[model samples]
Target chain A: MPRRDPAAFAEFVAARSPALHRAAYLMVGERQLAQDLLQESLTKTYVAWPRLRDHGKAEAYTRKVITTTAITWYRRRSWNAERPTESLPDTVAGGHDDAVTQREWLWTALQELPPRQRAAIVLRFYEDLTEAQTAEAMDCAVGTVKSQVSAGLAKLRDRLGDRFGEHADDLLPPTLMVVTP
Target chain B: MTELLKDTMDQAADSLLAPDLDVQAMVREGDRRVGRRRTAVVGAGVAAAVVAAIAVPSLLPQDQQRATEPVGFAAVFEAHQPSWATGSEVHVGGRSFDAGHQVFAYVQTTEGVVFSDPSGQVWASNGTQTVGVGRTDAEHPRLEADGSRVAWTTYGDGRPTEFTVYDQATGEVDGLAAQTGDAEVLALDGTDVYARDGREIVRWSLATGTRTSLGRPTGIEIEDVKAGVIAHQLPHADDGATSPYFGRELGETLAPDFYQTLALSPDGTTALGESEADVPALADTATGAVTPITVPGYGFFVGFGWVDDDTYVGLGVNEPYQTTPLDLLECEVGGTCTVTAEAIGSAASGVVLPFGQSMDD
Candidate 1:
């Protein structure tokens, strides 16, 4: 029967929306969809604000909401039907180094992964969350997180190898290079 | 790769300019949702009371006569427990008791309720005392009950090794050695138990101690079985799409992307079809026609079992979030739902319903 403080909710949203928006953009790979996802997730957070008890963890809660909602959205047949307009550049332009092209390729490849795998990769690497935290965000077991991240990274590496040949190994971090047996 | 992946992600994300926060708009939408939920709850309560008022007068004579009869699935809804009951608590018809441990999953039988604790120890409580039946190491052990028999699978090092059944009448437990350790018990119907081992659906006879293979079908895994009818999901397609189907003939597809638990009604004529994004629906086993059932004020329903051929009991989750509380609901197919109990706590709290044993497994 408690009421949610709109002013406090507004303050939290204003402060955290930027970072959450960035994460959402990485998740959905579309600017407008990311904005919508963030707004919808924040609305849910606001409704559950009364029971959230600790406002300190609100960001984590909203992040979880965004991750799950994005996955669910991607699961819909209609959402999958609508592809992103952004495409990877075919050739590197003047002043654009190989790193930029590789990054662009990685961006497109990341979008190609399944929603769960993409969310796992983003939560694990982009967010710099630990495996446990990533699992918590994804609402899955730690072993599942490891498998998803490993599988996603392997796909990225395979695609990178196809694009850059031997240079792929050099681009990959040593710690992640050992994920594959 | 972590650093490079992070940088790439950052660059991609940074390309987008963060939009201005619309705090007022979000607050308005959230408040509207909350208001609608509150109104629905109140309306449902008023409707139930009105229905009860009108029906009680005409049903008094029959209700008195039926009071002496044995309690069944219908009796579960008639029984009520305090909202403070913990997840380990068990409530039968007119009786309630604690199972002394957190019940991860449970099923109701004529003799009592059979449940499994977090440690894989299975127990049965007859609304009086509890008895340990067996233990299973399956990651998500499923319990099925019919009449006085309770069936489950016992695992060795995470693989199912035996099909075990307990007779509540005799208080005796029996085990049949699993032909393959990969097999897990899916349903118990009278003298036969159905299990999916590898890609085959095998039926083992308890009376004769013999096994029969039902042949490998379209589905990669069988979800539930009742009266020889199987509810299952086809293998993930090349596009990652899986459809749920029912019946021995595999005639009709229930719903597309029914990735959650698919529970069959007691009569096997209907199956509860659920998905991540849509409301729960009752799918006809014979025709695979889906009738979406909406539990007023709740995000979705997780059906435990059918009280009758038409009515099912389940938990109406407040929202899709993990932290939200659940309301015990009894709903009729294509009809109204009554809140049997409200705010019974969340699944994380281990609030096990009488028929919720197979849920989320």
Candidate 2:
């Protein structure tokens, strides 16, 4: 049969799917594509359930799949759009043009980044991975990760600096803070 | 060095970070599908022993074939695609080549680098394809031809990226902890492997965790622009932006030329690229000499292989006027080559990943 007790698996899905979808959405910038990627990775993980021996490692495997999927998706020319959707929701509306538009402005700015750079930013500041972990995820070097993060952040700064409040530089710290209590 | 830029990036990342929902559904679907497939296979076995023996081969067509002969090693390109039979599994996304004693690997993602293993197990750096860390989050970990050393990255969560080196013999991880630094282990030779951190790329002696700087790279350029994935080159922008205006205007675009298919020679001197120009091109990695092989009326080269440093084999479209299957070509260093066509059957669409312990291997 399947895993005798699948509640844990079900719970795992319920808890992680939203976050996974968000990450996927950012990476590919497509709701449907993100959903598809999430489904594909999750399905693979489920098939490997019998062999995944360690429950803790499941997330790692899934994440690897997600990143790999994003890379693969990025390779497809159809996935690359000149600009992601710029229309913002009314919820976050009505502030100074620059201040309120900061997030939307930055999102558009991010679309301009290279796929890997976009992935790095999404993984680094967004996902909160360490440089080493980000490197491993991207399948490159720590230096490459650093460069990507730096290059990506620099571009964002140049593109969105005007809108961000002062102290914006503190936003993309070169080194990630350790997750401490 | 700027804080406003950093904060804006931080905020942007935070804004985009959200839990994934589709992945969860697929996981559930995959589990159910695998169980169903297992039952089908079991049932097929019983029927095979009886009346369907003669009809089996005829019923199954072989349009695509899976290569099973294990050379020194193998790597996956695009990841596994899910299907009714096996759900999602392992995928071969890009290119693999050998560098002297080890094999070098690269991919189609924005994060690109050459990973090499000298002996069947041990890995080290032998070329200039340094790892691109902090640029992407795609990880497909494996050892070189020799199994002496193990290299893999820490993917997923926003931890610093790492290409780690572990002495298979000793089990100790070399260079950079997951949280503090970027870890990249490439071109491993014995205990000495080349590692790259966010600050720079260096050769680290695993035996001591000591490092030697390769100096700042000059020709190295980091473009935060995504090249069209599978389409030919995007329209050139005379406007001077690194990526064409098309990418900036549209969120994503596919350029067929971005579908890079790389094949390396055993010694790793000559590299062959299909899916590049309309004509096949042989590039000497060491000298950076690119020579294109011309084919009349054909679009770009699709797929190819390096039989040896001097000879190559590839699959390409021969006739421009006809709707046909891709054909095979045999090529040599001097641009002499012959072509042929093969009419093959088709196969089911499914992805198969190695089971647990097998993946560890």
Kindly report the docking quality category of candidate 1: incorrect
How would you encode candidate 2's per-residue C-alpha lDDT over A1-181 as one tens digit per residue? 1142366666667777766666777777666667678877777666655434444456755665688667866777645554355333334434456555555666677777778888887787667787777865676678888778778777766666566656455444443332111
TM-score of 2: 0.37
Model 2 lDDT tens row, B203-284: 5555565667754432111111111111111222221111111122222333222212233443444445532213356554
Clashing residue pairs in candidate 1 are A173-B1, B106-B357
Worst 10-residue stretch by lDDT in candidate 1 chain B?
A: B43-52
What TM value does model 1 have? 0.53
Error in Å for residue B303 of model 2: 16
Clashes of 2: 117
Candidate 1 lDDT tens digits, A1-181? 1358999998888888999999998888888888999999999888767645556567887887899899988888445568774654343334257778788778888888888888988997788888877876786788888888878877887888899998776666543543332
